[model samples]
Target: MISATELPSTRPYLIRALYDWCSENGFTPYVAVKVDASVQVPREYVQGGEIVLNVSMDATSSLKLGNDFIEFKARFGGKPRDIMVPIQRVMAIYARENGQGMAFPVNDDEVSSTPLTAVQPEPVQSLPEDDPTPTSPSPSRPALKRIK
Candidate 1:
């Protein structure tokens, strides 16, 4: 029984909306509140580095439910725990740079509150004019043939 007023954040409405969505869809919405540095990088997470997430819930719903928050937990190679996230406690709800992050913005009905804009870092490009030397040398061969 979390209060909308007690939740210290400007984005309380957004979090509430997410919670409702999760409840309706048989899931739990846990945003990143804190990160653990001593965790190991699982074999599956080799491509993408592991990120510790502090999932918030009204109760120990995540552990009791089990199925919810699987995607986030597995991606970071960690087991879900009972955590409470105040609206103001959330620093970032990041998934990844590969078009896989979650952002919540203030909305009218809370439906449009989730941050749809994924901040994917642009791919790096190489310069074409890096090589100063030409592929083929000029036809001016010095002393090609010396017939004595």
Candidate 2:
């Protein structure tokens, strides 16, 4: 049995919570992903080794946000395509309107196996503008808090 001390990663839970929050608040949810060999997405649309996708219900069909991966069918340039992204590859998920989102730190092991010398950093797309203005957190809006 798993002990309370050995908890699972909170990334997947946070993703689901944020996705639901965006949906309830009428905000378009978007996910930024780091592209690699394992990721299957439209290469032409990939910029700077990453791809930003709209995972809203209207934007995708048969969307499945699983703990290991997020799968969905979205149209690119009017052509339907299936997109698969590993949860570890998700850089951030945020509301497109207000830019309210959380960014995850990349683990060293998650880095590409290719040597740094041979790797070329692609121009990654920047996240939406985060409003620095402070706002009170309500029960309706999820916020990341650290417990000591």
Give the clash count for each candidate.
2, 2
For each candidate in the order shown, give its overall lDDT on alpha carbons.
Answer: 0.34, 0.76
* Cα lDDT of model 1 by residue, 1-148, tens digit: 8754444343445544554556555554444432223222233422223233423343333332121112222323346433322233233343222222345331222222233232233344444697665454333311111111
Distance from true location, Cα of 23 in model 2, Å: 0.5
lDDT of 2 by residue, 1-148 (tens): 8754455567778899999999999999998887888788999998877788999999999999987789999999999999998787778888988888886644435554322221223444545578555544433333322211
TM-score of each: 0.28, 0.70
Best prediction by TM-score: 2
Question: Where is model 2 more than 4 Å wrong at Cα?
Answer: 1-6, 111-148
